[model samples]
Target: MCALRTQFRYLNPYELHKIIINQYVLKQPEDIKLLQRNKSNDRTDYHVLVDHHRFLWEDNEPKTWEEQFAKRYFEKLFKEYCIADLSRYKENKVALRWRIEKEVVSGKGQFICGNKICNESENLRSWEVNFAYHEQGERKNALVKIRLCPSCSKKLNYHHKKREIKRLKKQSKYKKKKSDSKESGSEDETIVCDSSEPESSESRRIEADIPETSNETPWEEHKPEVIKSREEEMEDYLQDLLI
Candidate 1:
């Protein structure tokens, strides 16, 4: 189906924002691989995968019949499932099948939060924020893209934290490698930044020629003059006693 504009014109800005944020689905394993009824879902609430490629973009706007229909379909589900009655949403969608797409980008995109409560701008660093829509009996998976400022992204999307951690670790490791390379290069160049005055080569030679006190024997450290004075005192005292 083609993405459309007419069907979505009736939706106000607030509803559109909510539809954008709350309606899209994060990717799940079952979305790619078929699973048994019990294994199909890790979520207690009904969530589905969204196809990013299906939503066609014209002038950076969702302007196709299929895309618009998907938006409307997801909005309907959002109201009924997430906001309204879950039972009714599930009941209405058992046989209904359709394809819709939400806007998504992997990295380095502007983010405007579709949450009515939070309109946050995010630095696009990784592929963590996702969008999803429900498909009928068949399970499907496609990642919807979103952008939010660091704080809002973390608050709205749990995957944001994981991706952010990875990003930080990668950046730190890169910096460490760069630093190690720089240090090694400096050592190769002998770039020592000693604050003390550097000694002249002649002064260094003199210091090397001088005997190192550290190697001196303990007895050699005693003064010969002191030993001679002690010996003379002892001889004089013995001479006086004999007299």
Candidate 2:
């Protein structure tokens, strides 16, 4: 007998829930907005939907293109699926807003934790971390926010603190090493000076042992000797002959 094509038999809670929502949720058709007549052009302004829509939680401020898209997508998803109360899933109001913003900005379809290890799609919270980067040869600090599961969020905090401690320890070690090298260099210089002092003192003692002499001519070095002339020698010989 030929083997039957493989099929998925197991379903997780989320998958089951999604199936039930798809089958039971009441999806309503999109309602068309009334066309506004402009006297100048005698045409409808289609830009009203985009230009007039305001985002939630902001003082009725106009929404950006990303925000608008996100809002529409969220509403459509809710209409098609029986989504649980978003407040229960959101750790805070900020987290829900962040999730929505990320959806449209990043064009992501599912709301999942940013962590690769734990990509939980439910019960997410938003956190802001200080991210340092270099721009145009200058260091800059940016506040980067992301949604994460509770476990991943805890891990992120712990990792950040540990990294900070490690950086501080490395800085302190480098400073201590630099100070030690400087002290060693000074000691070497002092040792060299101390060694040279003995040689200088020895040279001074040798100079002191040597006797100093005043300026004198070379003939003065020998004692004076008596000299006899030829006539004096002849007279001495005559006296000897008379005797």
Candidate 3:
């Protein structure tokens, strides 16, 4: 019976069928239904959906994958994912709208929290994380937005409007301060010039009070000699009268 069992092992169609079937089953599903079911069970898994889009914020309804990613979902996730430090997740790389789709198909890339502390991971389908810049001609400001997982979103309790308003206010304040400092500096220079004018005039007066011997002429010294000669002639006439 042992020899017969060993001889039949290679011919066991059942074992061969089982192996073939398992491989076929694994290869059949384009989508991982198990993961989908798991994600659906927990709201936190929804963050993976954000990876489907890439935009920071949508001005209007998103029309293209690039537009959707750049403008709509990504910004929302960033607020949720933000954590303290934000530097440890050095392996995370920024994705372009085009690259995200390729990564999703390959089942490789996932969005990570830009914040180092959070280091949260999510599927590309759930959370859209985008790094964009707001630009109008030469003016530009960096915009970072992450579509947060449900758990992260709940944890953050973010206020988008408030943050935006605060950012704008800071910019305005900085501009005003810069303008004021420039004006004050210019005014100070003018005041210094005005103050120095009087000192310069006083210095000129002090210089003038010092007698200048260089201005004396040869004729001015001879006038003293002529006066002495006239005085001598008057004394001589007085002596003759006495004689």
The numbered model that scores best in lDDT is 2
The count of backbone overlaps in candidate 3 is: 32
Worst 10 residues of 2 by lDDT: 78-87
- RMSD to truth, every model: 28.8, 30.5, 24.6
Off by over 4 Å in 2: 1-110, 159-243
For model 2, how many clashes?
0
List the lowest-lDDT window of 10 residues for candidate 3: 159-168
The models' CA-based lDDT, in order, is: 0.44, 0.48, 0.46
lDDT per residue as tens, model 2, 92-154? 211112233434444332366655344477876665555554433556654445556666656
TM-score of 3: 0.19
* Position 242, candidate 1: lDDT: 100
Between prediction 1 and prediction 2, which has the larger lDDT? Answer: 2
Write candidate 1's Cα lDDT for 1-243 as tens digits.
235466468789988876655544333434533434566546321232244233222354556655555455444331100101112222332111222123223111334443323444555333232234444444454433333355544444432332432333355788899999998988885566878987799998998899857866789867585445888989999999999
